[model samples]
Target: MMFWLAFMLLLSAAQRGDAQWDWLTGIFGGGTTGSSTGQNDPNCGVAAGSRIIGGQYASQGMFPWQVSLQNLAQGGSHGCGGSLFNNEWVITAGHCVDGMTNPAMWRVRMGLASLQYYENGEQEFTVTKVIMHPSYTASAMGFPRNDVALMKLNRPATVSNYVNNICLPDRDASVGTNCVVSGWGVYDIQSQYFGQAPLSATLKWTYAPILDPGYCSQNYIWGSEMVSSIMVCAGYDHGQDDACNGDSGGPFICPSPDGSRWELNGIVSWGEQPCGAQYKPSAYTRVTAFKSWIQQTIQSN
Candidate 1:
């Protein structure tokens, strides 16, 4: 009788322990398990909270996929922002890597919230390969089309609470959906010398609602020629929130349709000067448009 009682007690303890674990996982997204090198991991896109830009500072680990694409040749200056696709790959805009394809000239800084100061859990990786989309093109005035690119790191990233992969969208987000845009870019658009304005030392984010393609094409200076089928338009008619210079190649992430996690929906591509201009929402490279290309390139290479 005593043996059976002890067995029941042990079983009850184990069940209670599992319940506690489940509660913790629900609160923190997931525990540190699963492979960090592949996108198949269930932990992808998990974060501590959801928020971004008219913009504000992001808490550490709030956007673990955010990364700074730094130019080593330019004294390690930040050239663009990117999203972590997987442990070994990063996604950015083709224009950001255009005419600057030398892998030796770049470094990727991850798990960091500031460009000017070192933070805990920061990781830096040397790039081994730069791959731009084959159909990528630039307009006469320097605007880009099919503006997506990928960078392969020398090795896979060491995933942690502060570093993780973002989910690739299974389908395109709907028009009017509010998405988050984060980067260490110029926050003040009203400066007289806007062209010479300094980039934000700390990361900033803002909310940009996806706009209708028809409306975007009509408002742009180049009209339909500029807002093609592969691009996405976001921001507002009043221009209160938008990505600007130094934010190129950053992520335009949105909540999954079910609101379980975040998904990378777009790549910051182009916007008008003195950004956040009325009726001129910023343009992004629609990530879903290149989904197959991204997967096949990563697989074959």
Candidate 2:
């Protein structure tokens, strides 16, 4: 009888474990196969199409790695955009968390396509730690240098059809390579009132092409030497589609050589005052330059 009781207890515990697993999987849309957790995962960067700044609305699961960094103190307002580095970490602009370094005050929302609506696959997590690069510099006259940052989630995100990680670039994308930048940023800069630009309710993306650093440096109001080696410039000569306010910290992703996966090449750093201004392309923090730093930081912390 005692032997039979032990068997029943084991069965009950197993059933409870299965039930808990099912509940979590149901929330994140995870399947029996489990969540994709690394860059090597075949499902990383898998999206419905190739695409984001004069950007169009993205469909569901179009950019699975996109993340909305929300400020809890401000009523969960979406402050900056980010990309999923992995199940436990998120990559974003350093300036986004500069003054707001308290991890408890921040939340990350993923698997989301709309800011106003919460979808079935959407996952939210409280940040446990915020790591900004030691060399990160915020400048009033020029774009921030070493603008990259990482936020550790309170819990690992479950990978699903709607959530995945983006692959980091091995090398810099060549000038003139077309890339996409996506966010829920402001749609109309001119329509803003009282110095406040309204953010988009839906995720939007636009195509931006990598531009020559020399040309970008020459065009900026700061003149030559404004565009640093660690930064990349991307936009058009006429400035039709460009990243604007509220789009900071988002990924500038380009297709790999074979076109099999998307690789993050840049992080939206800074831009001209009036967005989409002619001859004034936006500046992005070159991801390739800080690959080692990123790896070390993630590994040690």
Candidate 3:
């Protein structure tokens, strides 16, 4: 009953353009909107100059690793965000493909910024395979465990300024480190009414500071939910920016100490209610914790 209610609510909220309609809220008690059984628009109601909950429009060719996961089986529309890990592989949240595991039903859009426009550099590819973590499990309250997955592209992407890969983190993310998160999620969560604002069409980027696991688990919204060591929490003390319903599977990137390159530290998994509330940072699948799993999956398969 809860699943059905959440599914329906997500559909209605998305169609109504409800700004407060966040998937990782209490609808499923703690679920993310990236589920295959439900729907969230990739570029549904973007306002002219707004951004991802308090972010700024990402410059063209700035985030080459960004990718859009579109569900062609349901309809050729965007569903979730993804990271171009390599020429033939893309990384995303496990829940993004949980219900719809068929690779034939999915496609990836690369080298694009505006979701409304297919620019000259945009490229599309059919997904050939999906490799979800073996321990993945969706809790009754909607929290997903081991919420990470990898997709294989039908063909290798030709790397370019607008399309490339991001480096994976070599170690666990450090607390207090500032990272960049980019996506095309809801523009704002504080809108007074639904349908008043539009979703983000252009990719957006924001700054988030990594939080201490102890602080996140003891003082945040999901305190009773138990923070997993494999997950990393990050947000602002003021909580103006965050990853929302459609932002799942996107990359949480941190810059190198020397500022030479960006490393893939986390994958947007879920967050607290109302999207970006104060003292409620979002949770991400710690990429560093699954480094071996990722490499092993890639090498064996």
The candidate that wins on TM-score is 1
- lDDT of residue 179 for candidate 3: 76
Error of 3 at 251 (Å): 0.4
Q: lDDT by residue for model 1 over 25-59, one digit each (tens)?
A: 21233233432333444667776433322236666
Candidate 3 regions with alpha-carbon error over 4 angstroms:
1-55, 191-198
Instruction: Give the C-alpha lDDT of model 1.
Output: 0.74
The number of the candidate with the highest lDDT is 1
lDDT of 2 by residue, 1-301 (tens): 0000000000000011111111111113453222233333445555642332123676666778899999898788888889987677888999888878899899899988898988988999999899899988876664677899999888777777688777788788888887778887766746543565577788877777898887776744335757788988887767647777788898888877667677889988887665656677778889989888877777676
Error of 3 at 255 (Å): 1.0
RMSD of each: 14.8, 15.4, 11.4
TM-score of 3: 0.79
lDDT ranking from best candidate downward? 1, 2, 3
RMSD in Å for model 1: 14.8
Model 2 / residue 268 / CA error / Å: 0.5
| Residues 1-301, model 3: lDDT tens digits | 1110000001111112223212111111111122121111121111112222433666555676788898888787767888876466788999889978899999899878888997876779998889999999888877788989999888777655466666676676579987767787765766413644345778887777798887887843457455888898898656657777677888888865544456789998876545656677778889888878877777666
> Would you list the C-alpha lDDT of every candidate in the order shown?
0.74, 0.72, 0.68
Candidate 1: which stretches are off by over 4 Å?
1-40, 49-55, 192-195, 219-222
